[model samples]
Target: MRHHFSEQLDLVFDELAELCITVQIAVRQATEALLAGDGAAAERVISGDLDVDERRDRIEVRCFRILSLQQPVAGDLRTVVAALRMGSEVERSGDLAVHVAKVARLRMPRTAVPDELIPVVTRMSEIAVDMMGRTASIVAERDIAGLVELRALDDEMDDLRADLLQKIVGPGWTHGVEPAVDLALLSRYYERIGDHAVSVAKRVDYVITGERP
Candidate 1:
């Protein structure tokens, strides 16, 4: 019975890992579509998000099964609870990627980001993708120090968000309101993705230390 319970817990972990992979692909495709203004790529990402949602549901169900059947205690109990919360974060991060793709689709045939702000937007995407990759690794390792690092990394994205916002409203702005609104929403999508990654890491920290960071 003990061995079987252990197997069940491991299966739950596997589901969470799969969720991370789907989210990574979603962000990469979405960012690419956003920069290139490729409607097809954006559509692919939007479709991929459905798979991410399905994976999250599987993780939640697996966690619940383990809780009710295996009756995990102590650290194992913490692990199952954290998996539930992390699944939500992973799903939300995937949604943010979908939101980015939607913005790209909305302005199809024309880049949603202005030429002047392309560099900033590109940097934001890069950072967001890197953060998602780190989030996947942290999900497996559950490192407390890594949690601290994740928090600091999000601050950098926040700073970038502020910088991007300034460009849209500042005196030198030449792009009209529509493009400005698109850019603002684009920056926010990237920032929100970063925030979700950090939230997952915090969830992991709580499972490991029994204290949320």
Candidate 2:
């Protein structure tokens, strides 16, 4: 019975890892579509979000099953609970990517990001993607040490969002208010993606050390 319960827990962790990978790909593709102004790619990202949602639902169900059947205690309980929370984190990250893609689609023929702000937006995407990748690694490897670097990457993402906002509101701004608003939303979406990744990593840390970080 113990061995079977362990297997069930392993399956839940495996599903969470796969969900993280799906979210990471969504973030990358959404950023690419945003930068390139590819409406088709953006549409793809928007539609793909349903799969992420479904995966999260499956994770939740599995976690509940383990809780009901195995009655996990102590560290095992922490692991199951963390999996539930991490599933939501990654699913929300996927939604943020969809939000980024929607902005790209809305802009249509022209890119939403202006020429001057492209570099900052690009860097923000890079950091967001790196954070998601780290999240996937942390889940699969159960590496608590990687959480420090993941948190650092999140801080860098926040800084990039701040810089992007400053550029939008600074003098010599020729893009006007509408584009500025769109760019602001894009920055928020990317920043939120990093935030979700950090949340997931922290939950993993809690599962490992049996203490919230």
Candidate 3:
């Protein structure tokens, strides 16, 4: 029975790793669609969010089953609880990616990001994607050390968002208010995605150390 329960826990971890990968891909593709003004790609991302939701649901169910039946204690209990919380974080990241795609779709044929601001937005997306990648590795490897680097990347994301916001509201701004609003929202979406990745990393730390970061 102990061996069976251990196998079950391993399966849960494997599923969580795959879910993180899915979310990472979503973030990358959503950014590509936004920059290229590809309505088809944007639509694909919007539609794919349902898969993320379903995956999170399955993870939650498995964790709850382990909690109720196996009644995991100590480190095992922490792992199960952390998995539950991490699933929600990853799901929210996926939704943020979908939000980015929706903005891209809304401005189809013409890129939502202005030409001058494209570099900043692109960098922000790069950082967001990188954070998600790191998050997936942390989940799979249970490397608590990676949390430091992940948090640093998130700080960079925050700084980029602040810079973008300044550009939108600065004296030299030429883009109309509507575009400004969209850009602001897009920056927020990417930043929030990074934030979710950080949350997942902290949860992984909790799983390994039994203490929340």
Candidate 4:
């Protein structure tokens, strides 16, 4: 019985690692699609979200099984709880990626994003992706300091969002109505992504410190 339980634990860890990798790839694809203005690539990311959804379901089942069968205690119990929470966070991240892809598709062909907004929006995407990557590592290693750093990144993204909005409303922004609205909406989406990454970091803090952020 002990040996069988050990084997199951190993399997649980493997599945969690694989789920994290899928999340990172999804985020990267969405970022690249936006930067390249590739509608087809953006579509692919939007469609591929089912993969993350399925992975979340599988991870939930695995966590429940480990809890029911192995009867995890102490640190092992905390690990299972953390896995459950992480699964939710990753699913939310996947949804955010889908949003990014959707924005990319909407802005293509006509070049909805203005020249002034492009650089700021692009930089926002890059920073959010980096934060997500670091948060994933924090989850894997349960690094408290890394999680703190992830929270710090939120301020930068928020500043970028503010700056982009100011540019859109400024006298120089003559991109017309449609493009202006699209740029505003895209900035909001990027800021929301940063928020979600911060949420993930908070979860990591909970997992490591056993306290809410």
Best candidate according to lDDT? 3
**lDDT, candidate 2, at 119:** 87
**lDDT head-to-head 2 vs 4, winner:** 2
Per-residue lDDT tens digits for candidate 4, residues 71-110, read 9787667767877877887788788888878877777764
Task: Sort all candidates by TM-score, best to worst.
Answer: 2, 3, 1, 4
- Single out the weakest 10-residue window by summed lDDT for candidate 4: 9-18
Ranking by lDDT: 3, 2, 1, 4
State residue 133's C-alpha deviation in candidate 1, in Å: 0.6
Q: Give a tens-digit lDDT track for model 2, residues 1-213.
A: 789888988888788889988988888889888889887789889999999999999999999999999898989888998899899989999999999998888888888888778888889998988888888888887886888898888888888888778878999789899889998898999899898888888888888888876
lDDT of 3 by residue, 1-213 (tens): 789788888888788889989988898899989999988888888999999999999999999988999998888888888889889989999999999999998888888988888898989999998998888888887786888898898999999889888888999899899889998999999999999888888888777767767
Clashes of each: 0, 0, 0, 0
lDDT of 3 at 198: 89
Superposition TM-score, candidate 4 onto the true structure: 0.85
lDDT of 1 by residue, 1-213 (tens): 889987886677667767877888898899889889888899999888878888899888888888998888988888899899889988998999999999999888888887778888888888888888788888765565666667777888999999878878999888889988988888888899998888887787778778755
How many clashing residue pairs, candidate 1? 0
TM-score of 1: 0.94
Give the local distance difference test score of model 4.
Answer: 0.74
Q: TM-score each candidate.
A: 0.94, 0.96, 0.96, 0.85
lDDT (CA) per prediction = 0.84, 0.88, 0.89, 0.74
